[model samples]
Target: MISLQEENDLIDQILGGKQEAYARLVDNYKSYAYTIALKILNNRPEAEEAAQDGFIKAYQYLKSFNRKARFSTWLYRIIFNTAISYKRKNRVQMESIEHNDRGEESRESDLERSDKEVFIARAMEHLNEADRLAIQLYYIKEFSLDEVAEMMGQRVNTLKVRVHRARQRLADELTKILKEEALTL
Candidate 1:
């Protein structure tokens, strides 16, 4: 964990005209930020674009950051909103394009991973967006319920319920996917 004092120092440096200091902050949070965006958007390229846009927005708005909250919490809210907006914009763009108009350039690369990892990713897609993000923030990023609530602008109890239901839904989806896989095998 970065000490609060160190984070404050970095923020102070960024605010004091050392623009390069912001890169340190970006490096520190980029992985988690990308994961959050990917969970929301379910597309690698768009998620990357959204994460980058979120960092840009965060840098632009740094002067307004409230020190009372954790920087991660504040930054994640921006990422979540940016990814949601990206998803909506992409949805619209997709609707306007003829199916044949989508070129091969937009295709995702076939990166290899474990079957279980792939299954988990698919199961996450089965979840409602809120539940998916709740699971990701609580389990994947290991943020506290209160922290997640603060980031999502929701009550802690509501997030707790969302997480519980998300877990159950994930379990069900995993079961079904595994069975289907077995049949194919």
Candidate 2:
């Protein structure tokens, strides 16, 4: 991780016409940017494209970046917005299929895990976009609420409420699904 001082220096160099300095910033934040994009788009190719596009946009507007916020917070907001735009533009849904090969004992465990994942995913579908994004960022990605709120452009309290409500909805949905499955069995 780059120190805030080092990050500021790099920004200074980039603004002073040292293009290579920007590469360091991209390298430092690319994974995070890609992860954000992936969470939003749920497609590898689209996420990669969105992350790259976000970096380009950041660079294009680098001159206008005020020093009030950490560079990452600002960049992530841009990446989040870019990924959301991509999601809006590409409305097609793609489902991923996974195949697991393991020892017999592990196979059963994997199957259980996979089943739970399916249930959770199905529950997630019932959430509004903001609630879903809040849950994913806060729980799955392990971002602090402050960071998630900043990246999502919401007040911290608003994000907390969304996360809480999302969790409640997910739990209710999962319970309903599990009970239905139990009856079928």
Candidate 3:
């Protein structure tokens, strides 16, 4: 993790005409940005595009960034919003597990992995975007609740409620999916 002082120095350097300093920020946050984009866009190519565009946007608006928030939180908000915009403009179709008709063409391990992925994806689909993002930011990305709240522009108490409800919704969805799978078998 980049120290706060180091990040502040880099920000200052970037603001002072040192464009290369921005690359360090990108290096630090790109994976998380990509993950955020991927979860929202659900398409690798579009997610990559969104994440790159987010980094570009962040650099363009670097001078306006408020110092009170952690840089990762700020960058994450940009990436998340950019991905949502991309999703809106493109209206990408959600890839359903039903589309995987590859019967016996796959190996057992691959099938199991694909099934788990499908299960999680389908479960996530049941959630509203905010709830889904809250869960991802808190659990999958392992951000602190306080950080997630900041990124989401919500109070910590509100965020706790949101996360709890989102988890319950996910669990319900997973149970439903499991029942459907059992019936098929």
Best candidate per lDDT, number?
2
Worst 10 residues of 3 by lDDT: 97-106
Higher lDDT: candidate 2 or 3? 2
Give me the runs in candidate 3 sitting further than 4 Å from their true place. Answer: 92-115
**lDDT ranking of the models:** 2, 1, 3
lDDT string, candidate 2, 1-185, tens digits: 79999999999999999999999999999989999998898767889999999999999999899899889889999999999998877664322222122244345555777788878877888999889999988874557899999999999999999999999999999999999989999
Most TM-score-accurate candidate: 1
Question: What lDDT does the true structure give each of the candidates?
Answer: 0.85, 0.87, 0.83
On residues 37-120, what C-alpha lDDT tens digit does candidate 3 reach at each position? 887766678899999999999999988999987788898888878988888877634333324632332344346677877787
lDDT of 1 by residue, 1-185 (tens): 56788899999999999999988899989998998888777668889999999999999999999999889889999998898889887886766552554444223221465778778877987988789888887875577889878778899999999999999999999999999999999
Instruction: Pull out the clashing pairs in model 3.
Output: none
Q: What is the lDDT of residue 129 in candidate 3?
A: 82
- Each prediction's number of clashing residue pairs: 0, 0, 0
TM-score, each model?
0.83, 0.81, 0.80
